[model samples]
Target: MVTRVTNQGPLTGVRVIELAGIGPGPFASMMLADLGADVVRVDRPGGGGFGAFPGDLLNRNRRSIAVDLKQPEGRDLVLDLVAGADALVEGFRPGVTERLGLGPDDCLAANPKLVYGRMTGWGQDGPLAQRAGHDIDYLALTGALHGVGRAGERPVPPMNLLGDYGGGGMMLALGVVAALYAVRGGAPGQVVDAAIVDGVSVLATQIHALRGIGLWQDPRGVNLLDGGAPFYDTYECADGRYVAVGALEPQFYAELVRLTGFPPDGGDGPQDAGAAAGGEALDRDDPANWPALRAAWARLFRTRTR
Candidate 1:
């Protein structure tokens, strides 16, 4: 078995095998490597794609070995490494690993305690599991895309932050770690299918819960956290610079109103974070409420400097 020295950290003794792809594969392995796991990435023989660069921070903290998986000996070499690894991470689509002869069964047979982490856009089994997609497509499918941006305008993509990293690599890393813990508890290792759609959807649980309780709206950008509530939105100043406000609670909203010169009452010096943000904090029926307060704050902020 081959080994590499890693700096001391929480996972100092752990070993991981990473099958290189793009995006999430390097990202997840980076997390493991960052925590001092001896993560070795198996790259393809030719270095055409975004292979490791000296300045590539995500590809840092780990070493890589290249092998041609098209050859039987190359695949055997990876399975040999898997025998000594505690976990494995890959971001290929559904059956790509099976065709490469390095699927879950192949790796698990090499090491029963292996945490097989599969990262994908749709998931292992789904209607569109085999379909090609990117971060934008995953975010669009998960309802996260619609909740960002302004009300009337088209929803702007939040880039790859939400899907590719937040939902993809981050979730896969968390799943692998959690599965490794389960293995330590005498549980058999299993597949962690961390799909971008599933992870993004899980990240939107709060919005779903709030909507279920009538505290949120189904329409995009018209809710409290979305661009709906004026107190919780961004406004442009006279200098053309924008400032975001999230005075949701009564006390903080009171401070927001006071600072913006749109006091709910006529006289206002300065309201503290503990002061009233609104009537009963979240009283929708309060007279100095949204429609009027929103307009008031909009006008007040427009008059101020950046």
Candidate 2:
């Protein structure tokens, strides 16, 4: 048995075993560690994670030890750690851990109250569960990538933010926390299968609802929140830097217009700051006037510094 020191936070007494991988799994463990869980990262011998970078922020707030899991000694060491842990996080294709004798069943047998959080690109039992994929691939399959970028341009990758961290890591962390809560309430600990594809789909719930209500279109960058609206996108400044615009509400848009000295209409018309952005001659509600408004905003923003 090894003694561990935990920091002061919401999860002060909780212990987590993070089987080192990359991206989402590391991020999930990072969140737990941030909340003051004593996260023990089990790395393979010779060190691991992001080219063994010492400053990998995702591996922060935790202790780490290298163990060669291919050998019985290493596997036994991990099982010993699992026996005392409240949760375990691992990100790999399905069956990888099972083959390594570190699967949920193995760890759960060692500690039945363990929250076995599994992070993957697909899922545990899906058709592509064992397939290789990255954040972009998961987003693409979940219709998230399709909605990004301009209407006429190819889908632009939103980096790994959506699938890897937001959808994947956040969901896994939430699931672990929820499972821990249940365990405290006398419920049995269980597996949390947080697949990036499923998580990204859940993240797009608003878009699905909008599509169901006919308020959203199927094409990219043609919706109210998908950069189709002139007031909801970014514009370039004179310094070649870009600024994001999210003045969705009328008052906010009016404030934006006031601050930027922008004319609502393309011409030098009366600045109806009190007009609702959803209606009136503000032209914000009309899709036909979007091109002109976008052009005018573009021209105006180009005159600003940043």
Candidate 3:
């Protein structure tokens, strides 16, 4: 009989078996736990992951069991858990799980209805599938790394946020839910190859679409959203602090102009924002005027405090 865990969440009573790993895998399981799934993490005996952080929020909302996969008995323990679980998550690179005798086939055999989630930098089968890589390597290969940062400067990693959490972990969690949803419609269990490369690529959909329509450029910066426009970028204040502005729409930009003491146009204002900043007048829709606007905003911004 399946025990019902009441009052937790919409996912209450759902059981997930997570094979402990780092980064994306644990984060995915944490999302599962957050949604009220009864997630049981299988940590290696006396070999729990990344001992540096004790109060890891990722490990919360889930219980753990230690087992030695090197031992046949330990293998049996995980298989037994699989038989009673709704889904299983793992982040072993390529064939590591297969070598451990705990691949998708083994787990699926244990539970015919199981949704097996495999998280990796590359996918299950690709040119780079077997290549060892981390979040940076994956993001670099996916064109995402080339799309960030200030113009003419090196592209900055958004830390591991894009690859590990948003792209990999959150994508895996979404895939799990989607696979589980399919099972409700009489679909059989299947492997969810949640690759960080693939996930980050998906995150670039809008940019890709914009590029196709001649709106986005291939350079690191110099785009509407990626720190190209003055009104949409960060400014350093007088206190050595910074402030961000995102007046994307015309109305918002107008509001910003009205408030920041910048003129709405090169019109009859007492202080011409473009002239005072030693640049030509700026027209919002004219790409040629963007740099002038950026300079004007910068000059004004430097005069303010945080």
Model 3 per-residue lDDT at 203: 94
TM-score of 1: 0.85
- Taking all chains together, the TM-score of candidate 2 against the true structure is 0.92
Which pairs clash inside model 2?
A: none
Candidate 3 deviation (Cα RMSD): 3.9
What's each prediction's TM-score? 0.85, 0.92, 0.90
| lDDT tens digits, residue span 1-306, model 2 | 224455789999999999999999999999999999999998877774453587778878888888998998999999999999999999978998999999999999999999999999889886888788888899988889999899999999998899999999999999999999999999987899998988899999999999999999999988899999998999999999999999999788877876666775565444445442323455678888898889888988887788
Ranking according to TM-score, highest score first: 2, 3, 1
Clash totals in order = 2, 0, 0
The deviation in Å at residue 24 for candidate 1 is 2.4
Alpha-carbon local distance difference test for all models: 0.81, 0.87, 0.83
Cα-lDDT of candidate 2: 0.87
Write model 1 residue lDDT over 180-252, tens digit each, in one string. 9999899997899899998899889998999899888666777777777876878888899998988778667
Better of 1 and 3 by lDDT: 3
CA displacement after TM-score superposition, residue 105 of candidate 1 (Å): 1.0
lDDT: worst 10-residue window of model 2: 271-280
Model 3 collision count: 0
Off by over 4 Å in 1: 1-5, 50-54, 263-291
Model 1 local distance difference test score: 0.81
